[model samples]
Target: MGPPAPGDADDGTGQRTGAVIVVAGVALFATALLAGAALAPDVGAAGDDASGTLVGSHGGGAGLHERGSVYLLDGREIAWRAGDTDSYFDVTKLDNGSVMAGFMQSGYDECGPYESPCAHTGFRIIDPNPDSGADPEITHEYSFPVRSEKNSEVHDVELLDSGEFLVTDMDRERIFTVRGDEITWQWNASQRYDAPEDPTRTDWLHINDVDVIGEDRYLVSVRNAHQLVVVARGEGVVEVINEGDPESTRGDPTLLRQQHNPQWLGNDSVLVADSHNDRIVELERGADGEWTVAWEIYAAEGVNFNWPRDADRLANGNTLITDSLNKRVVEVNRSGETVWSYNTPEVPYEAERLPEGETVGGTSYADGGGDTTTIGEGRDVPVLSFLLVIVQTAVQTPFWFTEVHVAVTLVSLVAVLVGLGSIIRARVRARR
Candidate 1:
């Protein structure tokens, strides 16, 4: 009722008010600190944050598309992995246990000024042993050059026995052999097919695979052209196996649409992944010069295949299929029974079995142990660090103000008020 003055000796309410103010200030300071820590940027481990262990899908069901890490299976057990997974096109284990993988990344450019504008398309040979930790090491890397407006993304890279690198350049529609930084032998698709008005505008052919079949002969898959063309090393397109409209069906089985990975089976027979048709067809050339399907495998109830991309015939007469959209790699016997299978995190482009005696610790560098060197982990969002520093400064400013100026000012104000109240009380008592 406006009766309690500053010197209210009757109630002692002034002391209680000061105590509440101090408690509230402390609570606010503690809350600010906790919030700052909670909002700090996360800094994870170095050397490829994308790698991890492969986990099984729920219920272990077949054909269930679940995301997991990429791995190589040896009798249902993981033999080795880069400990990281990527949207890799072709992953092959060499005789020396080194792994070569071809992959693409969007909006990335690693080319120099004079070089072609690369669209983050490259291959890397991963060394699992590096006298370091378990993390794999990248020993060699090659980025495809983009000379035109078209993307220079490559689909397959084969380390040839002749010490040459055979790669498929989809953007240019060419198969070129690289030997020591030079294009030794090149085959242009435009030489055989009509060149687009804008070489950069058309992925016209979409040449996916280039397999060196024999002396001066290469088997290529022209997906958009809907044909398997055999091109001679020096000569042009020597043979067109399935040259026709992709929409129309041909031979005993239908034609291949958007197909990939045309592998040559001996005796003039070819095995190909008829991607859009959802089947693997093995074609054999008859004496009459007509191509006929010798054997074919289609998706069934349990052994389902969705957009199968790559099919390789193994030595034991089994086919290894990379079921792309379904997120699994399966090996089926001649009877089409699922003999072995492995799941992948993303759409698997191609998977191949390594030669025998190649295991996780089978590398020559394995005896060097893991390397202990630490590379600086790159920050995902650099601006977050700056923002955090600003917040930290703001939080500390209050504490500094309280300790250096506010605390002194409050103490002085309290003393002055108390002295004034004492004087007023003395005056009132004297007046009484």
Candidate 2:
């Protein structure tokens, strides 16, 4: 039969080869389509522009495989960069053209993982300018070591007027002030939450952030507990927001779910990056002492907020968001309209505008400001989410790469595999 005339198989060899080519073409097209969507301009970012520079701290993944950076963006481009360390979480501008960032790195001696040698976690005073255009110089640092870097590193630091830095030590489950080499004052979470024999080994109450809302008063974000506590120095926790979010006491996890970077809007109001809940929320405390979601936005510009780490209420009545997993920093009007946005270099942790910073408040959606429409209350797409985690470890994803795109890309891939199998079968049959 002369190998069935060399052209014949289950189907025709030529037909099978054509099918493979078609499938490969479709796969490439689908991939390019997702890439295009990612690089597209964010919706509503046109005439609504923004001015001034930005400073950011990116919390990179564990180990050196994915390192973080402390960066300064000049308008739309990066002006300077530093800390190719393991991760950086919080960064704030200092009066002297420098920056103070809460950071975590690897390789240290003495204490648990880095002591405060226990060497990786601590605060650093960095000069954003290096005359040679190299990595920014770390002028000074207050380092702390932890057992490991996961949930134990320092997350947030505030430079207080008294020259002491307010530090959030997740390993110790405490908020304290460190000036020079001494801890001036401290507040431990064990006093309020159930104590653990060894906090360094467990992901206990992750007290991730603290800010001086007023003299002698602080607003703290207890991430795992899903609440914010107002602590008055020496007086202990004066008022607990979201205390006992249980059915018995107040346990309303709906109010907050592992939130981060809350901005104190007023005595009765605060804006939170409701992280796990995938939204930016503003809470208002009533006369009865219960906090209610005054205003919240689930999605902006057609993309749902994913693991957003920080949201700041700017003085101009705009909200600046560090949308972490989405890998962009977005600024929205009081009504949650995207006024401006910048794609971050990686999975960023926090961002602050120069000059005004987040030191004050602007417009509050609690009272007025429309556009409070909630996008679909999102749920975790585990497979897509897992794929994204792996992809992001290697490259910065576009803000528009959502689950829909992931599903499309996956389907195209399966089709390509099927086509390859058809080609293999045809080749084998022809040989037989």
Candidate 3:
């Protein structure tokens, strides 16, 4: 195949393909990396209405690739495994340098792969360099209690400065918080939204991601409701912002299109992962509850993005987005120029670009629940849907170049290659 575009390849300039291969070979030589060291066995077709799982090849030993790596912008690198996951979805860097991840826990009676079936839910916090040989920790195991044994999964986790966390339980239609191991606050859609008197007649609100902007302000995504909502944190949720006017005769709700993960960029503007339509929209509150779309990244035509799940508005005015199904992470500047990129061997959910220019990301897979034929450590013991949160730092340094840096690297490499070609050509001419 022809070389990928600058925006498409990990090192946009394509100068480091040989370097990457060489590094991979050297690492393999130094360490016999385990392939799928702790992956779930391949189950049959998933059940109906179950939370879908992303599947990958069962190769080597564990059936899928379980290795993860992180890189710094200066070529320094580190690698780690997500400690056997089915799928690694959302990823974030906390104040303490530990990474928080959200993903599904497999093995439910309801649905199979890709089906919206009932499934167990959980989140993990992976320490890049845990106490030496000690395995990484999966903090706070959770299940979306209530509503039969089906498609209950936590999509993302919002960390508060106060050391609390907000979790988005999709099938349960609620957002809840945990502080010091206690359920401190909660919001149920049936009570928070304007639901019909007969709950049976009410539509299910598929709440996806939650973001805490202030001590009392939160932004939530309701997919079916097709809107991003801002609510207060208290005994009862109070509406502080609604992006659209919901077409309800009761005039109690606001209508909006598919939006998720509203993150506050500043006090007035916020960035949204508009997944359904494949875009990133910046909304700023205007008069009253009305919001204006200030900026957006359209995933149409020649655009480099496809199905962006979550995005971070970086301090440098650039954006790092998880191109979910594409299994890649993209860094786009304010001018929409893709400055850097990273491709994954599996599916991706969320990604975080650290201040040091390293990226930590997550991945997931289907076909969980090991059988007798499947043998591996951490297998049979719930492989947690192959969700990996990766931190890619070293390999990404070449792409963070300013125009001058890129120019210098490109000129140096090309000059050396051309000089060698000239020498070989001269030797051939002399022999003739």
Give per-candidate clash totals.
9, 19, 49
lDDT agreement of model 1 with the native: 0.57
Model 3 per-residue lDDT tens digits across residues 39-127: 32221111122111111111111321233222212111224445354445556666675666666544455443334454456465656
What is the TM-score of each predicted model, taking all chains together? 0.60, 0.80, 0.56
Best-performing candidate as measured by lDDT:
2
- On the 0 to 100 scale, the lDDT of residue 335 in model 1 is 61
RMSD of each: 20.4, 5.0, 20.3
TM-score of 2: 0.80
- Cα displacement (Å) at residue 339, model 1: 1.8
lDDT of 2: 0.76
On lDDT, the stronger of 2 and 3 is 2
Candidate 1: segments with Cα more than 4 A from true spot: 1-70, 83-86, 106-118, 130-133, 145-152, 245-253, 300-303, 356-432
lDDT by residue for model 1 (349-375), tens = 676755631111111111122222111
